[model samples]
Target: MSMQQFAGGNERFIRRYEYDDSWVIAADVGLDEDDIDVDIVGSTAIIVADTGERVTETEFELPSAGDASIDIHNGVLTITIQK
Candidate 1:
Protein backbone atom coordinates (compact mmCIF):
# COMPACT_ATOMS: atom_id res chain seq x y z
CA MET A 1 0.00 0.00 0.00
CA SER A 2 1.05 3.57 -0.65
CA MET A 3 0.12 4.62 2.89
CA GLN A 4 -1.27 7.87 1.63
CA GLN A 5 -3.11 9.86 4.26
CA PHE A 6 -5.66 10.87 1.72
CA ALA A 7 -6.20 10.65 -1.99
CA GLY A 8 -5.64 13.69 -4.18
CA GLY A 9 -7.86 16.49 -3.01
CA ASN A 10 -9.81 14.15 -0.78
CA GLU A 11 -11.25 15.39 2.49
CA ARG A 12 -11.85 12.45 4.76
CA PHE A 13 -10.27 9.77 6.93
CA ILE A 14 -9.41 6.32 5.63
CA ARG A 15 -8.26 3.10 7.22
CA ARG A 16 -7.03 -0.10 5.64
CA TYR A 17 -6.88 -3.70 6.80
CA GLU A 18 -5.14 -6.67 5.24
CA TYR A 19 -6.28 -10.27 5.11
CA ASP A 20 -5.11 -13.52 3.60
CA ASP A 21 -7.14 -13.09 0.45
CA SER A 22 -8.01 -9.41 0.27
CA TRP A 23 -7.76 -5.89 1.60
CA VAL A 24 -10.53 -4.00 3.28
CA ILE A 25 -10.78 -0.23 3.39
CA ALA A 26 -12.96 1.96 5.49
CA ALA A 27 -13.60 5.62 4.84
CA ASP A 28 -15.53 8.12 6.88
CA VAL A 29 -16.78 10.41 4.17
CA GLY A 30 -20.31 11.13 5.29
CA LEU A 31 -21.86 9.94 2.05
CA ASP A 32 -24.88 7.95 1.04
CA GLU A 33 -24.89 4.52 -0.56
CA ASP A 34 -26.04 5.92 -3.89
CA ASP A 35 -23.33 8.54 -4.04
CA ILE A 36 -20.22 6.40 -4.17
CA ASP A 37 -18.30 4.52 -6.83
CA VAL A 38 -15.57 1.90 -6.44
CA ASP A 39 -13.27 0.04 -8.80
CA ILE A 40 -10.18 -2.12 -8.78
CA VAL A 41 -7.60 -1.75 -11.52
CA GLY A 42 -4.65 -4.07 -11.45
CA SER A 43 -3.40 -3.61 -7.86
CA THR A 44 -5.18 -0.38 -7.13
CA ALA A 45 -8.48 0.43 -5.54
CA ILE A 46 -10.20 3.62 -6.54
CA ILE A 47 -13.03 5.18 -4.62
CA VAL A 48 -15.06 8.16 -5.69
CA ALA A 49 -17.78 9.82 -3.69
CA ASP A 50 -19.85 12.82 -4.64
CA THR A 51 -22.20 14.58 -2.36
CA GLY A 52 -23.89 17.98 -2.77
CA GLU A 53 -21.37 19.56 -0.41
CA ARG A 54 -18.22 17.67 -1.30
CA VAL A 55 -16.76 15.34 -3.87
CA THR A 56 -13.97 12.90 -3.06
CA GLU A 57 -11.70 10.73 -5.20
CA THR A 58 -9.34 8.32 -3.50
CA GLU A 59 -7.10 5.47 -4.59
CA PHE A 60 -4.66 3.08 -3.02
CA GLU A 61 -2.58 0.13 -4.14
CA LEU A 62 -3.77 -3.33 -3.27
CA PRO A 63 -1.77 -6.51 -3.00
CA SER A 64 -3.31 -7.69 -6.25
CA ALA A 65 -6.30 -7.39 -8.49
CA GLY A 66 -9.50 -8.48 -6.85
CA ASP A 67 -13.27 -8.20 -6.72
CA ALA A 68 -14.78 -5.52 -4.50
CA SER A 69 -17.81 -5.36 -2.28
CA ILE A 70 -18.93 -1.95 -1.04
CA ASP A 71 -21.42 -0.68 1.45
CA ILE A 72 -22.18 2.47 3.40
CA HIS A 73 -23.54 2.61 6.91
CA ASN A 74 -24.08 5.66 9.08
CA GLY A 75 -21.89 7.66 6.69
CA VAL A 76 -18.98 5.22 6.78
CA LEU A 77 -17.88 3.66 3.53
CA THR A 78 -16.58 0.12 3.66
CA ILE A 79 -14.97 -1.72 0.78
CA THR A 80 -13.68 -5.26 0.67
CA ILE A 81 -11.48 -6.54 -2.12
CA GLN A 82 -11.27 -10.26 -2.67
CA LYS A 83 -8.32 -11.64 -4.52
Candidate 2:
Protein backbone atom coordinates (compact mmCIF):
# COMPACT_ATOMS: atom_id res chain seq x y z
CA MET A 1 0.00 0.00 0.00
CA SER A 2 1.15 3.54 -0.76
CA MET A 3 -0.16 6.95 0.11
CA GLN A 4 0.53 10.16 -1.78
CA GLN A 5 -0.62 13.73 -1.71
CA PHE A 6 -1.09 15.83 -4.76
CA ALA A 7 0.67 19.12 -5.36
CA GLY A 8 -1.80 21.28 -3.56
CA GLY A 9 -2.75 22.26 -0.04
CA ASN A 10 -6.19 20.79 -0.40
CA GLU A 11 -5.49 18.04 2.10
CA ARG A 12 -6.27 15.36 -0.49
CA PHE A 13 -4.61 12.07 0.22
CA ILE A 14 -4.75 8.97 -1.94
CA ARG A 15 -3.81 5.50 -0.82
CA ARG A 16 -3.55 2.53 -3.13
CA TYR A 17 -3.36 -1.16 -2.35
CA GLU A 18 -3.18 -4.16 -4.61
CA TYR A 19 -4.49 -7.63 -4.01
CA ASP A 20 -4.32 -10.78 -6.02
CA ASP A 21 -7.39 -10.07 -8.07
CA SER A 22 -8.44 -6.61 -7.02
CA TRP A 23 -7.32 -3.09 -6.17
CA VAL A 24 -8.33 -0.82 -3.33
CA ILE A 25 -8.03 2.95 -3.11
CA ALA A 26 -8.70 5.06 -0.07
CA ALA A 27 -8.88 8.83 -0.17
CA ASP A 28 -8.74 10.98 2.92
CA VAL A 29 -10.37 14.27 2.27
CA GLY A 30 -12.75 16.33 4.34
CA LEU A 31 -15.80 15.81 2.20
CA ASP A 32 -19.02 13.87 2.33
CA GLU A 33 -20.32 11.26 -0.03
CA ASP A 34 -22.77 13.67 -1.57
CA ASP A 35 -19.99 16.06 -2.49
CA ILE A 36 -17.92 13.50 -4.31
CA ASP A 37 -18.06 11.98 -7.77
CA VAL A 38 -16.34 8.94 -9.18
CA ASP A 39 -15.87 7.86 -12.76
CA ILE A 40 -14.07 4.87 -14.12
CA VAL A 41 -13.22 4.23 -17.74
CA GLY A 42 -11.07 1.44 -19.04
CA SER A 43 -8.17 1.19 -16.57
CA THR A 44 -8.42 4.72 -15.25
CA ALA A 45 -10.35 6.06 -12.32
CA ILE A 46 -11.22 9.68 -11.74
CA ILE A 47 -12.37 11.15 -8.46
CA VAL A 48 -13.67 14.60 -7.88
CA ALA A 49 -14.76 16.28 -4.69
CA ASP A 50 -16.40 19.62 -4.27
CA THR A 51 -16.08 21.15 -0.87
CA GLY A 52 -17.11 24.75 -0.53
CA GLU A 53 -14.51 26.83 -2.37
CA ARG A 54 -12.17 23.90 -2.87
CA VAL A 55 -12.61 21.44 -5.66
CA THR A 56 -10.13 18.62 -5.85
CA GLU A 57 -9.58 16.00 -8.51
CA THR A 58 -7.58 12.82 -8.55
CA GLU A 59 -6.88 10.35 -11.31
CA PHE A 60 -5.29 6.96 -11.10
CA GLU A 61 -5.03 3.67 -12.92
CA LEU A 62 -6.78 0.47 -11.95
CA PRO A 63 -7.04 -3.07 -13.12
CA SER A 64 -8.30 -3.80 -16.59
CA ALA A 65 -11.31 -5.94 -15.67
CA GLY A 66 -14.15 -5.97 -13.17
CA ASP A 67 -16.19 -3.21 -11.62
CA ALA A 68 -15.58 -0.53 -9.03
CA SER A 69 -17.56 0.37 -5.97
CA ILE A 70 -17.22 3.58 -3.97
CA ASP A 71 -18.39 4.54 -0.54
CA ILE A 72 -17.67 7.34 1.89
CA HIS A 73 -17.78 6.90 5.60
CA ASN A 74 -16.40 9.18 8.29
CA GLY A 75 -14.79 11.45 5.72
CA VAL A 76 -12.85 8.65 4.09
CA LEU A 77 -13.59 7.70 0.54
CA THR A 78 -13.03 4.05 -0.14
CA ILE A 79 -12.91 2.65 -3.63
CA THR A 80 -12.74 -1.03 -4.32
CA ILE A 81 -12.31 -2.77 -7.64
CA GLN A 82 -13.11 -6.45 -7.89
CA LYS A 83 -12.19 -8.85 -10.60
Candidate 3:
Protein backbone atom coordinates (compact mmCIF):
# COMPACT_ATOMS: atom_id res chain seq x y z
CA MET A 1 0.00 0.00 0.00
CA SER A 2 1.06 3.56 -0.77
CA MET A 3 -0.17 6.95 0.33
CA GLN A 4 0.16 10.54 -0.83
CA GLN A 5 -0.92 13.80 0.72
CA PHE A 6 -1.97 16.77 -1.36
CA ALA A 7 -1.04 20.35 -0.58
CA GLY A 8 -4.64 21.42 -1.04
CA GLY A 9 -5.88 19.56 2.02
CA ASN A 10 -6.50 16.24 0.34
CA GLU A 11 -5.00 12.79 0.75
CA ARG A 12 -4.96 9.58 -1.27
CA PHE A 13 -4.33 5.92 -0.48
CA ILE A 14 -3.65 3.14 -2.92
CA ARG A 15 -3.34 -0.60 -2.54
CA ARG A 16 -2.34 -3.38 -4.89
CA TYR A 17 -5.20 -5.84 -5.29
CA GLU A 18 -6.08 -8.56 -7.76
CA TYR A 19 -9.57 -9.92 -8.29
CA ASP A 20 -10.18 -11.29 -11.75
CA ASP A 21 -6.90 -10.06 -13.13
CA SER A 22 -5.05 -7.23 -11.35
CA TRP A 23 -6.09 -3.84 -10.01
CA VAL A 24 -4.94 -0.86 -8.03
CA ILE A 25 -7.31 0.56 -5.44
CA ALA A 26 -7.18 4.24 -4.57
CA ALA A 27 -9.05 5.76 -1.65
CA ASP A 28 -8.92 8.19 1.31
CA VAL A 29 -9.85 11.43 -0.41
CA GLY A 30 -10.46 14.54 1.63
CA LEU A 31 -12.53 17.06 -0.21
CA ASP A 32 -14.14 20.12 1.26
CA GLU A 33 -17.27 20.01 -0.77
CA ASP A 34 -20.77 18.64 -0.72
CA ASP A 35 -20.40 16.41 -3.75
CA ILE A 36 -17.48 14.63 -5.35
CA ASP A 37 -16.59 13.68 -8.90
CA VAL A 38 -14.25 11.08 -10.29
CA ASP A 39 -12.46 10.65 -13.60
CA ILE A 40 -10.74 7.46 -14.63
CA VAL A 41 -7.90 7.67 -17.13
CA GLY A 42 -6.31 4.30 -17.72
CA SER A 43 -4.48 3.47 -14.45
CA THR A 44 -4.84 7.05 -13.29
CA ALA A 45 -7.91 8.67 -11.73
CA ILE A 46 -8.95 12.17 -10.83
CA ILE A 47 -11.24 13.45 -8.09
CA VAL A 48 -12.90 16.81 -8.08
CA ALA A 49 -15.86 18.82 -6.95
CA ASP A 50 -19.10 18.17 -8.68
CA THR A 51 -19.64 21.90 -9.04
CA GLY A 52 -16.24 22.31 -10.74
CA GLU A 53 -14.84 24.23 -7.85
CA ARG A 54 -11.62 22.27 -7.29
CA VAL A 55 -9.95 19.19 -8.70
CA THR A 56 -7.50 16.61 -7.37
CA GLU A 57 -5.94 13.89 -9.45
CA THR A 58 -4.39 10.68 -8.15
CA GLU A 59 -2.61 7.88 -9.95
CA PHE A 60 -2.79 4.21 -9.06
CA GLU A 61 -0.85 1.22 -10.37
CA LEU A 62 -3.02 -1.79 -10.93
CA PRO A 63 -2.09 -5.35 -10.19
CA SER A 64 -4.00 -6.87 -13.10
CA ALA A 65 -7.48 -5.35 -13.82
CA GLY A 66 -10.56 -4.65 -11.73
CA ASP A 67 -13.26 -2.16 -10.85
CA ALA A 68 -13.60 0.28 -7.94
CA SER A 69 -16.24 2.36 -6.21
CA ILE A 70 -15.95 5.63 -4.36
CA ASP A 71 -17.42 5.97 -0.88
CA ILE A 72 -18.30 9.37 0.47
CA HIS A 73 -18.72 10.64 4.02
CA ASN A 74 -18.62 14.16 5.38
CA GLY A 75 -16.85 15.22 2.17
CA VAL A 76 -14.30 12.47 2.65
CA LEU A 77 -13.81 9.91 -0.10
CA THR A 78 -12.86 6.27 0.15
CA ILE A 79 -12.46 3.78 -2.68
CA THR A 80 -13.54 0.19 -2.40
CA ILE A 81 -14.23 -2.81 -4.59
CA GLN A 82 -17.25 -2.40 -6.82
CA LYS A 83 -19.88 -4.99 -6.16
In candidate 2, what are the lDDT values of residues 1-83, reduced to their tens digit? 44444433555667777777677877786678888898887778788878878887877776564688888898887878886
TM-score of 2: 0.70
Top-lDDT candidate index: 2
Segments of candidate 1 deviating more than 4 angstroms: 1-11
Candidate 2 ranges with C-alpha deviation above 4 Å: 1-11, 63-65
- Ten contiguous residues with the weakest lDDT in model 3: 5-14
lDDT of 1 by residue, 1-83 (tens): 43334442445677777777777778787777788887777777788878867887777776566677778898888778786
Instruction: Give the C-alpha miss distance for residue 62 in model 2, angstroms.
Output: 2.1
Per-candidate TM equals 0.64, 0.70, 0.42
Candidate 3 ranges with C-alpha deviation above 4 Å = 1-34, 50-64, 81-83
Across residues 2-45, which tens digit of lDDT does each residue of candidate 3 receive? 44443333334434443453233534454544666765555455
> What C-alpha lDDT do the candidate models reach, one value each?
0.73, 0.75, 0.49
Which one is best on TM-score? 2
For candidate 3, list the clashing residue pairs, or say none.
22-63, 22-64, 22-65, 23-64
**Higher TM-score: candidate 2 or 3?**
2
